[model samples]
Target: MQCRIISIGNELLIGDTVNTNASWLGNVLTEVGIDVTHIYTIGDDLATMKDILSEALSATDLIITTGGLGPTHDDITKRAVTELFDCELVLEDSVLDFIKKVFKKRNIPFSKSNYHQAEVPDCCEVLFNTHGTAPGMWFDRGSVKLAVLPGVPHEMKHLVNEKVIPKVRAINGDTEFRRSHYITTAGIGESTLSDEVVGSLVDVLPEHVSVAYLPSPQGTRIRISAYGSSDDEIDERIAPVRDHIKQKAEKYIIGEGKDLNLAKAVGDLLVEHEMLISVAESCTGGYLANAITDVPGSSRYLMGGLVAYANQVKENQLGVSTDDLNSHGAVSKPVALQMAKGVAKQLGADIGVSTTGIAGPSGGTEEKPVGTVWIGFWNQDEHFAIKAHFTNDRQINKERSGAVALEMVRRSIMGIKEMPYGFKKYPA
Candidate 1:
């Protein structure tokens, strides 16, 4: 089924709040085999809401709207829906009781304005909202169905999962439609990955499946979508193609589906192998360690880290030799490797990762320019380091350095001999 999401709020247009509801709804609908074709965000103007709603009903099988359901005068979604359906507004006693009980529990006085929340169109069925006072409204007009949900995220999610989806399934019934899978890869550019995949596996992909390349600063995401098939059939069709793509990009492919973070992926690998890790950070300022520790149960593998931004700290804390810093500089490969080895030995960890760079709006020279980063990793048996020259802004360079550090650590643990793209690797 094709669906369109309408987010109504002046706050969204003015940048006072983000329209996360639309993105959430789109993802949820896609998982349930529904295609979300468009998302509209508009102010709380009555005429605009009415026109958009009318237009959506004409073109889409399902229309989901969020916001403008409060008791304020600007909240006009209920009135707009009533006029569109040509139905009278009727107050629901059960909803009114629930609202009163909510206010009574909090010892707050309930006013007549709150009664507006209890009013629903005569022709619509109310979808009860257990999370909030404003219940959702469900309307059926011909073959199109419209569900009006609260703008609050938690309230909307509760209604969609508990009420709206079940209603949709009941009306449409179970049918084998389509399935989609995602393959996430990092440490490679999107254009390069696409070029590699297009040449070999594009034609071999099943007729029912289509591939899309989604690129971001983190990495490229390859989506394999299969339409008009059951779950088993879609899996059977995608299996060989997925395998071929994996083989082509095995070194670059870090994780699958929603597990895209290179740091988190490495953290999982460390936990699975029962390996411990420590880090020494310079320009990235402990960002690599922060990313690793963000995953739950990471304490099992992450030992700790030191943000040695100052030269004295690098020398005193991480044991980077003062001679190396004075001669080769802090961002040099030799210094980075020493920092990794020092931290691993100090913390007594199985693995150590370190990042040193000049991530800068300033701090560039003819020899070592800005975005010059050296990432290093050390294990008991081996040590390795790589130099990367990124040209983005300071914050982006730092983030990229952290991601690259995690990827290096992952390769080091997996016993990969060299870095991808012909980059030079320092030995232990």
Candidate 2:
């Protein structure tokens, strides 16, 4: 089914609040085999809400709106919907009773403003909101279905999962829908990966299955969507193509779907293999260690880390040679390798990861300009260093360095020999 999402709030338009509702709803609809064609964000103005709703109903099979459902006067979603459907606002006694009981249990005074929350369009079906006071409303206009949900994330999620989705499924009945699987890849540029996939695999993929490349600063994700077939049929059709793509991009492919964080992926690999890791960070300032330990049960694998920001700390803590630092600078590959191997040996860990660089708005030279990062990983036998020259903002450069360090750890754990470009091996 085709769907359109409308997020209603003046705060969203003014950047006072994030419109996370649209992203969440779009993902939910897509999971249920519905195609979200457009997303509209409108201020709390009644005319804008009405116009967007009218346009959405005419164009899409399902119209979902979020926000502006509170008891305040500026909350005009229900009023606009009622006007559009030619219905009158009726106070629901049951909802009012629930609200009163909730307030009574909490020992709080229930005001007249709270009563306005129970007022709904007379023609629409009320969907109970167990988490909050605002109730969801569902209206059927000809062949199109419209659902109005509260802006609160928790309340909207509960209503959609418990009530809205079941109703949508019942309406959809036995209509066939497509299913897609996402494979996330990193360490390769989007244009390069796209060129390779389109040139090689386009002709081999079946008519029922297709691939789409989604790019962000982190990496590119490949989504394999299958249409007009049963689940088993779709799997059968896409399995070979999926396998072929995996073979083509095996080195770059990290994890599946939204499961592609480098730290988490590497941590899982370490846990599976039963290994411990330590870190020594410079320019990244313990970001690599923080990312690794952010995953639950990371204590099992992540021993600890040190942020050796000053050159003296690097010499004292990680044992980086002062002579080396003075000769080749702190961001050099030799210093990176020494930092990695020294930390692993000192902490008695199976692996050590390190990052040293100038993630800079300043502190750059003519040869080594801003965003010069050297990531290092050390196993028992040897150390490896990768030099990355990123041109993004400082925060993004740090993030990229952390991700690449974790990827190096993953590669080491998997016994992958060759490192990517800008990486070199050093003897133990």
Candidate 3:
């Protein structure tokens, strides 16, 4: 089965709103073994809406539309859909009563325009949406099934999961399902990880398996996707490719599963080792600490953090040496080392991590230029710092630095000598 998603809104076209709905629908549809062939993001124009609807009905097995289902003047999706189906708009008392009850619960006065929300095309089955004001509708036009849903993300997701997926599941019973397994890696560039590290997949991939490298600011995820009738068959198909990539990139592979991340991996290791960790950040501010604390049960391992953005804060709070700040500057190796050790002592933590850098579009010098970062680590047995060069973008630099810091902690806990990104670790 194939699906087409039509997004109707001027805000999306004008870049005011993101077209996340289409992407979400695409992923969900694909997981159910339905191929999402086309995504049409148009404005709230009646003519274009009617044309796209007509085209999708003729071209695809399923059609889902989002947006333009409001009470405003520009909300013309329902009208266009009704006109195309040659049906009259009839009021559904159940839907109207629900809307009225919701409004009364919120202590809001009901208006005439809201009455339009309860009216549905005579040719469609009302897919009741309890999450929002607009009720979703389903129409079976010959071969194609059209599910018109609200543009609100939560409402759309609710309707799809509650009402639409069951129908799709019934129609696609016992058929092949599309699924993916993700191997997440941090502190590695996409090009280097793909071209040199993972190498070619020509011989490793099975008959129906494929690999894709998804890179972001924090890390890279290698997706091993396959099609099979059951989970066991898909697992068998992807195992060879997954094992091969793991073998090739063993040290860099942080964890598996689609939602695996550096912070969660680090938190797990910290828990296993029964160690408490503290963070002292300079250029990255509280980003490193926030990432760590984002994981659940992090309180067991994460002691605390300090955002020592100012030189005085670095000295007075983290106890970075006054001499080093004057001589080597804040973004130097000595300061990084001292900051890491100082934070550990200050918080009485078993381990301390620090990031000091010039993350910039500016604030660079001849010797210490932009994107120059020094990440430090300190424990009872060992203390060292790793220097890395990153991008010109400030946000990217921050994300990469935080990721590298987490990866460094992970490697050290696992007793892996190899440094993240193969950078030389400088001893204090």
Candidate 4:
């Protein structure tokens, strides 16, 4: 089934409220084998609501709208829906009784405006919401289905899971079930991974399976989804495509599961290899350490970290040479390498990683410009540093540098020779 979501509120348009309802609904609907096409966010205007509702219903077989279903005057969704369906407003006695009991329990007098909450169109079926005052409405016109729900997140979610989904399944019986598998990869850009490494999924996937490349600051999550009636059937159908991707992108793929990040991947590898690691930070501050410790059970392999932001700390704490700092500066490869090796030796760790860079809107020289990062790695066997130039945004540079540093650790431990972003390691 094809579906569209309409989020109605002046708060959403004015940036007072985020449109999280649409995203939640889209994920839920897509899991049930419904293809969600568009999401429309509009203000609480009556004419606009009616026009958008009409257009959405005309284009898609299923339409879901959330918001503007309160007792206040700004809540005009019920009115718009009633006018569009040309139905008379009728008071539901059960809903009115429930609202009255709720108010009485809270020791508040129910006013005339509160009665509006119990009113529904004569032609629609009411989906009782025990969590809140607003009742969900369901209207079926021939083949098109429209459901009007409350704007509150908890109430909407409860109604969707308890009421709406059951009704939808009853209407469309024995349909295909959808499942998705995520293959995460790092140390590569999206274009390079897609165009060169994992090219042309057409021959790899079956007719029922599809692929989507979701990119973030940390890495890219390759999603492979398929539809089937049974779990075994779905898994069997997707096996060939999944294996083909793993074979092609074996070097770059970090781990499986949708919520996997670079930190978790590196931590897992560290535990497997029985190694401990430490970090010395300059430009990225504590971001590298924070990312590493974000994963649970990180203490098993994470030794410690030092944010040596100043030259004095670099020389005093991490034992970076004063001569090298004076000659090559803090952002240079020599200082980066020294910091990594020094931290590893001082902290008694099997491996050490360091990040030194110029991340800023200001502080740029012709030779060492902004976002010029030197990431260093040191182990008992080898020690080297790689140079990377990121964006001018400080936050972006920090995130990119941290991700690359973790990926570098993962690659080095796994005996991979290539560096992140294809940058050659200095002093090779």
Off by over 4 Å in 2: 100-109, 197-199, 257-260, 426-428
Return the clash pairs for model 3, or none: none
Best by TM-score: 3
Which regions of candidate 3 deviate over 4 angstroms? none
TM-score for all predictions? 0.90, 0.90, 0.96, 0.83
What TM-score does model 3 achieve against the real structure?
Answer: 0.96
The worst-scoring run of ten residues by lDDT in candidate 1 lies at: 196-205
TM-score head-to-head 1 vs 4, winner: 1
lDDT of candidates 1 onward, in order: 0.86, 0.84, 0.92, 0.92
**lDDT per residue as tens, model 3, 266-381:** 99999998999999999898999999989999999999999999999999998888998999999989999999999999999999999999999999888988999999999998
The residue-by-residue lDDT of candidate 1 on 1-428, one tens digit each, is: 88999999999999999999999898788767788999999999989999999999999999999999998888999989988888999999999999999999999989888988999889999998879999999998879999999999999999999999898777766754666788888777877888854445656787878888887656678888776546888888888878878888888888787655777788889988899999999999877888888888889998889898998998898888999999999999888899999899889899888899999979999898998999888887878788989885898888888877777777777877667444688775
Clashing pairs in 2: none
In order of lDDT, best first, we have 4, 3, 1, 2
Residue 267's C-alpha lDDT in candidate 2?
Answer: 77
Q: What RMSD value applies to candidate 2?
A: 2.5
Q: Which stretch of 10 consecutive residues in model 3 shows the poorest summed lDDT? A: 50-59
lDDT of 2 at 29: 81
Model 2, residue 96: C-alpha shift (Å): 3.3
> What is the full ranking by TM-score, best candidate first?
3, 2, 1, 4
lDDT of 2 at 417: 72
